[model samples]
Target: MNNAAQYDTVIVGGGPAGLTAALALTRYRHRTLVAESPAAPRNAASRGVHGMIGLEGATPAEVRARAWAELDAYGLTERRDTTADDIAPAPEGGFRTMLGDGTQVWSRTVLLATGVIDIHPDVEGFAACWGRTVIHCPFCIGWENADRTWGLVADDADYAAMAATGFRAWSADVIAIAPPGMDRAEETQRALRAAGSDLVQGEITRLHHHDGDLYAVEMADGTLIDRQTLLWAPPQRQVPLVTRLTDTLGLALDDDGFVTVGADQQTSIPGLYAAGDLTTAWEQGAMNAAGAGARAADAVHFAHPA
Candidate 1:
């Protein structure tokens, strides 16, 4: 085996979280390596990234490209086309990782920014309308598509409450579609009714699209509801890197299958940290990832103060 390549820190996945952490570490004069399997396509489906300063309406690829450019200018070493396969505890109180191409890297600290994947609802032609008319986030797409007919597709009662709050700004004519056995609370029903939203009871059978635009949703009972836009919360699953590394390093995962991290973003395993969506179930975008990455870098700096 080749000798382990050493750096002050190694960051896995070059999304907003990893890039932000790498930039912060570089400013502190720490040698950092960023392993990116490949950049995502510009047309990849995402509603929009919210809460990012000066980039409220930006798409995921747009935000990532801008961040990458900024980090590149700062001389951060980026390893495109490389993937971290496994991470193990190092004897000298750090961590060692194996790359997909058989390269080994040793670092004083490791930060995982591997993002989560959205579990899309099984609806016909829904993929084509994603990121355009069928969106996942209200904070991101509500302002853009305001005053249009919006449909909130959900199967959980709690999600109905959350969706009620989020979709209030877009349009007063919101429809909450819930499956059987999931009853909305009295307060939730009152609030939604007060907001002028009608509760539609049915399991969505399929999405109807016309010329790549969302047209309507068909219910299982043959009910067709015309809608201009569809919004819903996505069930999420962590990227495979989280599971691979956790198993390799024997790190602990929380009940929700997220990497268990303290306030400092440090995992149960020493010298290893995780931030962003990999550690949280809440809906977070570029802003949250960037903030978490910065905090993780600062925490690592404290642990190994120069």
Candidate 2:
């Protein structure tokens, strides 16, 4: 609770987006502070992040470590085990943020890189296999699980169609498992059939696992479908921290509950910016985060020219 420490910009959440933002601002000689909550929530369920240059196959932890190391080299300040509880507009055209430990930081600007969380299915044993055999996003994990027996566990027909496109490049044995009476579009059905995927209609009651490995899926009728990998889409919800802060600061959110930002990553609220998954619907990793962070930092610099 050191109120004496102030910064030109305070970034909440030290994931890829926040870390990148901190690095960019510090490189520009802007005094920046990053408050990161400890590791607790589950992020992308993959061993390594994909589509990122240079560190393409690095794990999330590895990417974060490398980025933090670089930030440290640049003399950026970081405070771990801290959380931002509230943010209000400062009278001097900035922001006043209160931390969970009762520390207050007054910054000329604030960056909300707080990411989102995925809501997994309630099926038994599903949580245990997540990030290993049970995963989401084919772009990130499909290459690793390529040519293996993959199952698409989805509740909606539209999701099944989208999954079809993403999984097509990985394996030809992709199966769309949905509940009975869920009719799929002709285009999707044709694509599934053309891709040699079976349309499995059943009510999945549970997931069977062994030693952290997914073994099979059990349907309500007692039928077991054995598979090496299970891919499914999770209903995503914005992590509460970002939404609450956006509400407190009167920032605008899009229809899907993501923070609405302009091209420069500046939100409707002046001096408050957002980036990464909190601002975009596309799948993003370290590269996207870095790009967005640079954009937001540039905008902040333009707005607050010294």
Candidate 3:
């Protein structure tokens, strides 16, 4: 392998976590290679990032652009716009990663910031309106769509109840749709009714949209709910690369399939770490992921210091 192809750290996924880690690793003068797939990011369709100071309302593409530029200025980190096909601990030391383009790179440590994939409901127009009009994070999109028709789709009655009531702060016209066969708790029902939120009991048959803009939702009972924005709380899973890594490298995972890591962000396997959404179930945001990435970079830096 060429010297240029050998890095002290190989970070997978070019989202905020991996990119931020790259910035920190290279700032410490470590040779870092960030392998980012060309696929669309989780928040690609969102108008802007929210809650983060100084970067409020910045688009995902803008964040990545700035990050890659900064990393380039350091001249220690390189980016490969390709997916990591496979990874295995090398016999000599460290790990070897095969890129989707058939190139192999060796690194002293590996960080998986590959993130997660939201398992959206297979409802018509739901996938098309994701990130655009249908979003999961209330903090991310609530302020902008405030006072508009809001719908919360969830299986848990407590969650639906809380979301329906809490969303009243954003819009008085909040609706909670509990899945079929699940009874709403008495307290939950009381909360929704008190908040003046409508409770619908049925499966979402389809989301109605036109010209890529969402307009309404159709329930199984043929009831059409006029909703411009939807607060979709769907289950999410680790990306395929993380799954493969956990299997091939004997890495430990939580019951929810997220990679288990310590406070240092180190995974079960030595010289391997995980950060961002793939490591936590709560607080899945770009800013949070970036902070985790920086912390993971610290762990990697201390582990393999010059």
Candidate 4:
């Protein structure tokens, strides 16, 4: 058997969460290894990332570059642009991880910073506007386009009504499009209208955009309604690595299919921690993920103090 390299921790991602954890660990002077997959990041299409202080209006690349640059000063981390193909408890202790390039590494602790994957709806051209105008979070993308026409792709009546009404803070003109079979549709429409908002029933046939710049949404009958932005919280799933290991590692997942962790970001499995979107959808953002990463690093450091 090939001798495995050892480290304090092996982070399975290199985005905001993973990089932030590395930053925190390096602050403790711990040897850390970060394994980032070769695939493009999830936020590749974002025009700008808002609501994150100091990083406001930064593009995904810029945010990543700034994060990566910060790590250089520490000089305490080893970065590999490869996927963690497999992860499991080592016979001796800690964990053993196989990289995509077939190298094995052993770590005293492992941080699963691997984020979630957003499952887009089946509307034509919806992807064209995703991460730009077709966003999931208002706080992150609503400021620049505030007061413009906005659309909410509602999956249910309550969700539609609540989100559409709350969206009034960002735009005077807000509309909710709820597909067929929505419960309490009438009540939701009445509530929305009373709140000075509008609700449209049935499916959206297409997203009207030019080069990914959204301007409207097309109904099934081919009716187009002007909308500068669309707030649609699509369903998400853990990345393939986490999913494949959920049962193998016996990791606990929440009802919503996110990895459940303790107050310190440690997963159900000992010496295994998780952070970012893989943990919770609530407050899902790079900034929030970074905060979670910081907490996990603290926990890991204290747990293995010299």
Candidate 4: worst-modelled 10 consecutive residues by lDDT: 158-167
TM-score of each candidate?
A: 0.88, 0.89, 0.93, 0.96
Q: Which pairs, if any, clash in model 2?
A: none
Q: Rank the candidates by TM-score, best first.
A: 4, 3, 2, 1
* Each prediction's whole-model lDDT (CA): 0.77, 0.77, 0.84, 0.87
Model 1 Cα lDDT, one tens digit per residue, 58-129: 877787778778777878565556878888777776788888887888888999988777777788877788
Better of 2 and 4 by lDDT: 4
Model 3 Cα shift for residue 229 (angstroms): 1.8
Model 4: pairs clashing at backbone N, Cα or C within 3 Å: none
Cα lDDT over the full model 2: 0.77
- Residue by residue across 1-306, what tens digits does model 2's lDDT show? 234456789898887788878887887888888877775635645578778778788877887788888888878566556888788887766888888787888888889887778787788988888877887666767787788788987766777765456666887676778777776645566777776666678888888889658778899999999887888766777776677866665778888777899998999988899888778666455568668888888888788752
Best by TM-score: 4
lDDT (tens digit, per residue) of candidate 4 on 1-306: 258998999999987888889999999988999999889988887887776789888888898788878888788888899999889889889899999998999999999999999988898989888877888888777786687788888877777887555877888888898888889988888888888887888779899899877898899978788998888888999888888788687788989999999999999999999999899988688889989999999999999752
Which candidate, 1 or 4, would have the higher lDDT against the true structure?
A: 4
**Two-way lDDT contest, 3 vs 4, winner:** 4
Error of 3 at 103 (Å): 1.4
Task: Please state the error at residue 73 of candidate 3 in Å.
Answer: 1.0
How many residue pairs clash per model?
A: 0, 0, 0, 0
